[model samples]
Target: EPEVTQTPSHQVTQMGQEVILRCVPISNHLYFYWYRQILGQKVEFLVSFYNNEISEKSEIFDDQFSVERPDGSNFTLKIRSTKLEDSAMYFCASSRDRVDSGNTIYFGEGSWLTVV
Candidate 1:
Protein backbone atom coordinates (compact mmCIF):
# COMPACT_ATOMS: atom_id res chain seq x y z
CA GLU A 1 0.00 0.00 0.00
CA PRO A 2 1.03 3.59 -0.58
CA GLU A 3 1.94 5.80 2.37
CA VAL A 4 2.71 9.30 3.51
CA THR A 5 6.22 10.09 4.78
CA GLN A 6 7.29 12.66 7.37
CA THR A 7 10.72 13.99 8.27
CA PRO A 8 12.63 14.53 11.50
CA SER A 9 11.01 11.62 13.32
CA HIS A 10 11.71 13.42 16.55
CA GLN A 11 12.54 17.00 17.41
CA VAL A 12 13.02 18.96 20.60
CA THR A 13 12.45 22.70 20.52
CA GLN A 14 12.12 25.61 22.91
CA MET A 15 8.76 27.07 23.64
CA GLY A 16 7.91 30.17 21.58
CA GLN A 17 10.15 28.99 18.78
CA GLU A 18 9.01 28.14 15.30
CA VAL A 19 9.07 24.68 13.73
CA ILE A 20 8.27 23.24 10.36
CA LEU A 21 7.47 19.53 9.88
CA ARG A 22 7.66 18.21 6.37
CA CYS A 23 5.74 15.46 4.56
CA VAL A 24 5.45 13.75 1.23
CA PRO A 25 2.04 12.27 0.58
CA ILE A 26 1.37 9.44 -1.80
CA SER A 27 2.02 10.55 -5.34
CA ASN A 28 -1.54 10.19 -6.56
CA HIS A 29 -3.44 11.32 -3.49
CA LEU A 30 -5.49 14.49 -3.87
CA TYR A 31 -6.47 15.33 -0.29
CA PHE A 32 -3.99 16.09 2.47
CA TYR A 33 -4.39 16.49 6.22
CA TRP A 34 -2.49 17.13 9.42
CA TYR A 35 -3.41 15.42 12.67
CA ARG A 36 -1.73 15.44 16.04
CA GLN A 37 -1.91 13.23 19.09
CA ILE A 38 -1.01 14.66 22.44
CA LEU A 39 0.69 12.06 24.62
CA GLY A 40 -1.93 9.47 25.61
CA GLN A 41 -4.71 11.51 24.03
CA LYS A 42 -6.92 10.88 21.05
CA VAL A 43 -5.83 11.96 17.60
CA GLU A 44 -7.14 15.38 16.65
CA PHE A 45 -7.53 16.87 13.25
CA LEU A 46 -5.74 20.13 12.69
CA VAL A 47 -6.39 20.95 9.06
CA SER A 48 -7.15 19.62 5.63
CA PHE A 49 -6.19 20.96 2.19
CA TYR A 50 -7.32 20.17 -1.30
CA ASN A 51 -6.82 21.86 -4.64
CA ASN A 52 -4.48 24.33 -2.91
CA GLU A 53 -7.02 25.70 -0.43
CA ILE A 54 -7.95 24.77 3.10
CA SER A 55 -11.07 22.63 3.03
CA GLU A 56 -11.56 22.57 6.77
CA LYS A 57 -9.80 23.18 10.07
CA SER A 58 -10.38 22.53 13.74
CA GLU A 59 -10.28 24.95 16.65
CA ILE A 60 -6.87 23.55 17.50
CA PHE A 61 -5.53 24.91 14.26
CA ASP A 62 -5.38 28.53 15.28
CA ASP A 63 -3.33 31.32 13.72
CA GLN A 64 -0.24 29.66 15.09
CA PHE A 65 -0.49 26.72 12.73
CA SER A 66 -0.16 26.66 8.97
CA VAL A 67 0.06 24.15 6.13
CA GLU A 68 1.56 24.41 2.67
CA ARG A 69 2.00 22.42 -0.50
CA PRO A 70 5.15 23.95 -1.90
CA ASP A 71 5.35 21.57 -4.82
CA GLY A 72 3.69 18.59 -6.41
CA SER A 73 5.14 16.20 -3.84
CA ASN A 74 5.71 18.07 -0.62
CA PHE A 75 3.18 19.08 2.00
CA THR A 76 4.35 20.85 5.12
CA LEU A 77 3.03 22.01 8.48
CA LYS A 78 4.49 25.03 10.20
CA ILE A 79 4.04 26.12 13.77
CA ARG A 80 4.67 29.85 13.95
CA SER A 81 5.14 29.91 17.73
CA THR A 82 5.41 26.70 19.60
CA LYS A 83 3.91 26.34 23.04
CA LEU A 84 4.42 23.71 25.72
CA GLU A 85 0.97 22.31 25.04
CA ASP A 86 1.91 22.00 21.38
CA SER A 87 4.13 19.04 22.08
CA ALA A 88 2.72 16.06 20.26
CA MET A 89 3.16 13.52 17.50
CA TYR A 90 2.19 15.12 14.21
CA PHE A 91 0.87 12.77 11.57
CA CYS A 92 0.62 13.63 7.91
CA ALA A 93 -2.18 11.86 6.05
CA SER A 94 -3.42 11.58 2.50
CA SER A 95 -6.44 10.23 0.69
CA ARG A 96 -6.80 9.41 -2.94
CA ASP A 97 -10.39 10.67 -2.87
CA ARG A 98 -12.84 12.36 -0.58
CA VAL A 99 -13.78 10.54 2.61
CA ASP A 100 -17.44 10.63 1.73
CA SER A 101 -16.49 9.02 -1.53
CA GLY A 102 -15.18 5.96 0.31
CA ASN A 103 -11.50 6.70 0.21
CA THR A 104 -9.28 5.63 3.06
CA ILE A 105 -6.80 8.02 4.62
CA TYR A 106 -3.25 6.77 5.00
CA PHE A 107 -1.07 8.12 7.80
CA GLY A 108 2.66 8.57 8.17
CA GLU A 109 4.71 7.33 11.12
CA GLY A 110 4.54 10.84 12.54
CA SER A 111 6.99 13.56 13.58
CA TRP A 112 7.35 13.84 17.32
CA LEU A 113 7.72 17.39 18.61
CA THR A 114 8.71 18.12 22.16
CA VAL A 115 8.58 21.66 23.44
CA VAL A 116 10.69 22.73 26.34
Candidate 2:
Protein backbone atom coordinates (compact mmCIF):
# COMPACT_ATOMS: atom_id res chain seq x y z
CA GLU A 1 0.00 0.00 0.00
CA PRO A 2 1.19 3.54 -0.65
CA GLU A 3 2.14 5.43 2.48
CA VAL A 4 3.36 8.86 3.56
CA THR A 5 7.14 9.17 3.87
CA GLN A 6 9.23 11.63 5.93
CA THR A 7 12.93 12.41 5.95
CA PRO A 8 15.55 12.78 8.68
CA SER A 9 13.70 10.41 11.00
CA HIS A 10 14.95 12.62 13.82
CA GLN A 11 16.45 16.06 14.24
CA VAL A 12 18.17 17.99 17.01
CA THR A 13 18.44 21.74 16.79
CA GLN A 14 19.30 24.69 18.95
CA MET A 15 16.84 27.29 20.04
CA GLY A 16 16.54 30.18 17.55
CA GLN A 17 17.72 28.01 14.69
CA GLU A 18 15.66 27.15 11.68
CA VAL A 19 14.49 23.67 10.73
CA ILE A 20 12.64 22.10 7.89
CA LEU A 21 10.84 18.77 8.04
CA ARG A 22 10.15 16.99 4.80
CA CYS A 23 7.29 14.67 3.87
CA VAL A 24 6.07 12.87 0.80
CA PRO A 25 2.50 11.69 0.99
CA ILE A 26 0.84 8.98 -1.09
CA SER A 27 0.99 9.87 -4.76
CA ASN A 28 -2.72 9.60 -5.35
CA HIS A 29 -3.71 11.52 -2.25
CA LEU A 30 -5.22 14.99 -2.72
CA TYR A 31 -4.92 16.48 0.75
CA PHE A 32 -1.81 16.94 2.86
CA TYR A 33 -1.47 18.00 6.48
CA TRP A 34 1.11 18.61 9.17
CA TYR A 35 0.55 17.71 12.78
CA ARG A 36 2.75 17.48 15.85
CA GLN A 37 2.72 15.81 19.23
CA ILE A 38 4.67 17.14 22.14
CA LEU A 39 5.96 14.33 24.40
CA GLY A 40 2.96 14.40 26.74
CA GLN A 41 0.52 16.47 24.78
CA LYS A 42 -2.25 15.76 22.37
CA VAL A 43 -1.58 15.55 18.66
CA GLU A 44 -2.12 19.04 17.28
CA PHE A 45 -3.00 19.99 13.76
CA LEU A 46 -0.71 22.64 12.33
CA VAL A 47 -1.84 23.09 8.76
CA SER A 48 -3.66 21.47 5.88
CA PHE A 49 -2.81 22.00 2.24
CA TYR A 50 -4.68 21.14 -0.94
CA ASN A 51 -4.72 22.31 -4.56
CA ASN A 52 -1.42 24.09 -3.90
CA GLU A 53 -2.77 26.29 -1.11
CA ILE A 54 -3.43 26.01 2.57
CA SER A 55 -6.94 24.90 3.35
CA GLU A 56 -6.68 25.36 7.11
CA LYS A 57 -4.22 26.23 9.83
CA SER A 58 -4.25 26.07 13.58
CA GLU A 59 -3.25 28.89 15.90
CA ILE A 60 -0.01 27.06 16.38
CA PHE A 61 0.93 27.95 12.84
CA ASP A 62 2.15 31.41 13.70
CA ASP A 63 4.59 33.76 12.04
CA GLN A 64 7.41 31.34 12.67
CA PHE A 65 5.90 28.43 10.81
CA SER A 66 5.08 27.74 7.20
CA VAL A 67 4.09 24.82 4.97
CA GLU A 68 4.60 24.38 1.29
CA ARG A 69 4.50 21.92 -1.58
CA PRO A 70 7.65 23.09 -3.31
CA ASP A 71 7.35 20.33 -5.89
CA GLY A 72 4.21 18.53 -6.98
CA SER A 73 5.27 15.48 -5.00
CA ASN A 74 6.73 16.70 -1.70
CA PHE A 75 5.24 18.67 1.16
CA THR A 76 7.34 20.44 3.78
CA LEU A 77 7.12 22.27 7.10
CA LYS A 78 9.60 24.98 7.97
CA ILE A 79 10.14 26.56 11.34
CA ARG A 80 11.72 29.95 11.01
CA SER A 81 12.99 29.71 14.55
CA THR A 82 13.05 26.79 16.92
CA LYS A 83 12.02 27.07 20.51
CA LEU A 84 12.26 24.57 23.35
CA GLU A 85 8.52 24.27 23.20
CA ASP A 86 8.81 23.26 19.58
CA SER A 87 10.36 19.93 20.41
CA ALA A 88 8.00 17.19 19.35
CA MET A 89 7.23 14.48 16.85
CA TYR A 90 5.87 16.01 13.67
CA PHE A 91 3.65 13.85 11.50
CA CYS A 92 2.61 14.23 7.90
CA ALA A 93 -0.64 12.83 6.58
CA SER A 94 -2.60 12.54 3.37
CA SER A 95 -5.97 11.44 2.07
CA ARG A 96 -7.39 10.59 -1.30
CA ASP A 97 -10.13 13.17 -0.87
CA ARG A 98 -11.11 16.19 1.14
CA VAL A 99 -11.14 15.80 4.90
CA ASP A 100 -14.88 16.32 4.87
CA SER A 101 -15.35 13.49 2.39
CA GLY A 102 -14.75 10.71 4.93
CA ASN A 103 -11.56 9.52 3.32
CA THR A 104 -9.07 7.68 5.47
CA ILE A 105 -5.92 9.69 6.17
CA TYR A 106 -2.54 7.95 5.99
CA PHE A 107 0.30 9.25 8.15
CA GLY A 108 4.03 9.14 7.85
CA GLU A 109 6.20 7.37 10.40
CA GLY A 110 7.07 10.73 12.03
CA SER A 111 9.96 13.12 12.34
CA TRP A 112 11.15 13.62 15.86
CA LEU A 113 12.33 17.17 16.52
CA THR A 114 14.35 17.91 19.62
CA VAL A 115 15.17 21.51 20.38
CA VAL A 116 17.58 22.37 23.13
Which candidate wins on TM-score? Answer: 1
Model 2, 1-116: lDDT tens digits are 88899987999999999999999999999999999999989999999999999999999999999989999899999998799999999999999997765789998999999999
lDDT of each: 0.96, 0.94
What tens-digit string does per-residue lDDT give for candidate 1 at 33-78? 9999999999999999999989999999999999999999999999
Clashing residue pairs, backbone N/CA/C < 3 A, model 1: none
| Candidate 2, poorest ten consecutive residues by summed lDDT | 98-107
lDDT of model 1 at residue 38? 98
21 Cα displacement, candidate 2 (Å): 0.2
Deviation of model 1 at 14, angstroms: 0.6
TM-score of each: 0.97, 0.96
Candidate 2: residue 25 lDDT (0-100): 94
Clash pairs, candidate 2, are none
lDDT of 2 at 22: 98
Residue 10 CA error for candidate 2 (Å)? 0.4
Off by over 4 Å in 2: 100-102
| Candidate 1: residue 46 lDDT (0-100) | 96
